[model samples]
Target chain A: MTTAKRDTYTPETLLSVAVRVFNERGYDGTSMEHLSKAAGISKSSIYHHVSGKEELLRRAVSRALDGLFAILEEEHACAGRSVDRLEHVVRRMVEVLIAELPHVTLLLRVRGNTETERWALERRRDFDHRVAELLKAAAADGDVRGDVEVRLATRLVFGMINSIVEWYRPEARGASDREVADAVVRLVFSGLRQG
Target chain B: MTTAKRDTYTPETLLSVAVRVFNERGYDGTSMEHLSKAAGISKSSIYHHVSGKEELLRRAVSRALDGLFAILEEEHACAGRSVDRLEHVVRRMVEVLIAELPHVTLLLRVRGNTETERWALERRRDFDHRVAELLKAAAADGDVRGDVEVRLATRLVFGMINSIVEWYRPEARGASDREVADAVVRLVFSGLRQG
Candidate 1:
């Protein structure tokens, strides 16, 4: 049953609806029927915009990955001292994640159950490895603590940054994204103890 | 399909099998048939051990929650100064999490889609609230920093701890549990920057 609104269903908008459904029902659990219903369109209309749900997933994750990878090319991320650049990247990651919340959330939840998911997983690891290298460089510069291994510190820091998606609601009037990013920087660099 | 090995399938052993399958396939995605096939037993034989998959989920999460709650009742967690007690609870949390990785992993992934999952999520919030209280007390005592809000600090720290399940493998031959816990404690109190 195609409605007159079918004219409004561009591939980008359809991908947005698909990502929300995927986040709710899970990438593995969601079917095209669910996507069509959530999108208020027929399955064939969805197919007309994109090849399948997997293409929608690929598009969604690619958007998130592009946002993240773009941060590394920024001047602050590339030109500062290792620790400073690391901080810039961390702050930008929070901003990017908040700005692209749904897409990144979907990207984070992929479990490599399909070819598209596996590709997303591989890119995620590459992104993580690049960040780990920054941490390692900081350690070598004696700017960061040496007691914790670079790899372990990288994982824990990413863990702290990523877990923001679990509780952050832009509508909640809680901490602003800037405030949250500030708190993360403070905690990651100076920790919770009184100085 | 009930073999002579049916005699070997106690409720606890069967619960273990069910939990592994639930973790892999997700609780909503798993069916009784999946559990039975994974356990190498017939559906009725599996049923003899528990009421259903929900019972298995309840049992698994209860084990994890109990381990965490028990940490609060310990002497170090209860009897020391607030900051010390908070530290004790944090260390024990890492230990308990590593010891009960699969159960807690399953618990962390719960989305409240079912009554059992909703109960688990509620209890998890209760647990988080209790830890937040300790951090509040520590800040009141001037032992912890006051700039970051207690609730936000509690969440960031827990996020770092809870994310341990995503990558930590007991077989990885990387950091030992003690070392990992020590790193977490140091990172929380002192942070990544060098003096």
Candidate 2:
């Protein structure tokens, strides 16, 4: 093998190739042969870095989940008024989602057909509930309108945020990450109606 | 077959069962055997009704697209002020989504794996652009905020609206269709932050 190709073949780099294929063919649809071909490495070589496709899946979701859960640990997420903290979390979520688009997109599409998928789903639910609690607190503080149920509002807003995976192309000449986050926050905090 | 079992089996009824399994198992993972097992009917019986799995997928997405496209043709959608028309379409959309929850859910989850899936995605994009135009008109009339890009706003709003399929359970003691529509309209029109 050439030195340049060999140098670029770390587990992480192989993983980037694996994720792109996985997203394209789908997790279940993808096989080691597919990854092997996509990575330009032998199947045995892929096995050297990871046990199998499941391990790769586990690693990808773990990264995405860690990025999401880390947001809750930040001082801005924990301190300040509930509404302001919620805003901080919302904005950071957009950033994290953009930064880890493929990983999170894969995470969102899991169908719970396997052990790793179920675990990923449970962790996702936990993250959602934590964010929902912030919205609930904001509602209780009367800083957010109480007209809409907090739980429903949280899910819908999340739906809005998470739906970014369906369309936001990091390559597209669309709005930047900060710009999209600003629009989301503005719409979330204030309605689309004329003031 | 018993009279009750005979009564339970129809193309529409069988399609419903197939859609549920298609959602639980990713469409690619699901097989004719899986549908047969889920429906408690033989493979031959299923073929007797709809040809095959692709037919079920086609029917489900067609139903969803039809519901969405019909919204654009409504009198309120066409006759009123741009903002009001958009509001009407948005409200009707939530109702249609709830009414045809499973079908729409299947439509949103499609990954364009086949010719049928690709067509569904194209139709979905067309529907989105049609709504985007309404938002643009509302912006032009100065009835909606001009600060956020209209195309971006349409997508985020759609992301929030389409998200209902993710969590809404017709069986659960959650908000009714009207209540959810009200919340969506309120959030879409006004800011979620307190005045």
Candidate 3:
């Protein structure tokens, strides 16, 4: 084995490999050795890029959370009729999810074992609460349904959106991010039942 | 540690603990040592109760699959208008899912890593196909809408229903299984939009 390094792998490239392995074996099941093999680098070389396995996890989840939170700050999400804003946020979320598929997939699968995971879970709840507030505003404006509990509606809507990760294969379908986003928006606003 | 002989744990009881831990720290994340710790038994004792960790997983997922498949065989699911039968199956699925929470939770989380998981996935697909056939029948009868693809509609409906496992905590909710099932049926079929 050549001990001398030639071209160094960027942290982003390393993270791409690590997240793939983490998704395959699961976050907890994956080890440094597994990551090293997947990345085609020495175990010691991995440390040169990331502190360890959990650091990779933290970075991955952080990327996902950042993308999601960014949606709330978008102009369309910020300024519109309450229902329209809610729809925009929902549509944007699907786009971001597909764009950052691996990171978001990792975020959705967190089981809250370590401090970092617990923190991720808390932020996730906060994100849900933020959206729930939007739904409540929409309901108050008489734009959306008011009979169902806001919390329950939010959970169900988010569930439908998040479940896309389970079956959506970007490579196979050749589906553009916008197309998926449009489908999600259309389904969410209009019930499957005929109008 | 007490070296005294103890009564053997039944597969059912052992499976309950295993599914809980599996959900707590994903299927791949858990080990025999974790199971033993959770079960208050030695690792070898656990092996005596069940062949291995994967066997426990198989038993748990099998129980869940059996409950779900049994819904299709029921009188209500079998003998009715196509839409009625579809509704009956959907409602019963929610009930079974809540009643057999832990087992079903394990079933939903399987990632097809082992033979047992692959089998569970295949069975799940069979169940989905059965439901989709019902939806197609309903669409043919002009009861349910045909605007959405039957397959896509089935998946979205299933996604909405299956997500209950992630947040539905029975102990804290105080809602009966029937109540939860009713809510799910109402939300999916009727939707959150007020007329």
lDDT (Cα atoms) of all candidates against the true structure:
0.92, 0.91, 0.84
lDDT of 1 by residue, B116-190 (tens): 999999999999999999999999999998889898899999999999999999998899999889989988988
Which pairs clash in the backbone of model 1? none
Per-residue lDDT for A1-195 in model 1, tens only?
A: 255688878888898899899998898889999998999988998888889989999999999999999999999999979999999999999999999999999999999889999999999999999999999999999999999998899999999999999999999989999989988998898888887
Candidate 2 residue-wise lDDT, B65-180, digit = tens: 99999999999999989999999999999999999999999998898889999999999999989899999999999999988998899999999999999889999999999999
Please tell me which model should have the higher lDDT, number 1 or number 2: 1
lDDT value, residue A51 of candidate 2: 93
TM-score, structure 2 vs. true = 0.90
Q: Give each model a TM-score.
A: 0.96, 0.90, 0.86
Estimate, for each residue in A28-133, the C-alpha lDDT of model 3 and write its tens digit: 7888999988888888888987789989999999999999999999999999888889999998998888899999999999988888889999999999999999
Q: Arrange candidates by DockQ, highest first: which order?
A: 1, 2, 3
lDDT by residue (B1-195, candidate 3, tens digit) is 344334657677788888999988888889998999998878888888888999889888888999999999999999988888998998999899988899998899888888989999999999999999999998898887766677777777788788888888888864567766766666666665456
Best by DockQ: 1
> What is the CAPRI rating of model 3's predicted complex?
acceptable
DockQ per model, Cα: 0.78, 0.77, 0.35
Once superposed on the true structure, which residue ranges of model 1 sit more than 4 Å away at CA?
A: A1-3
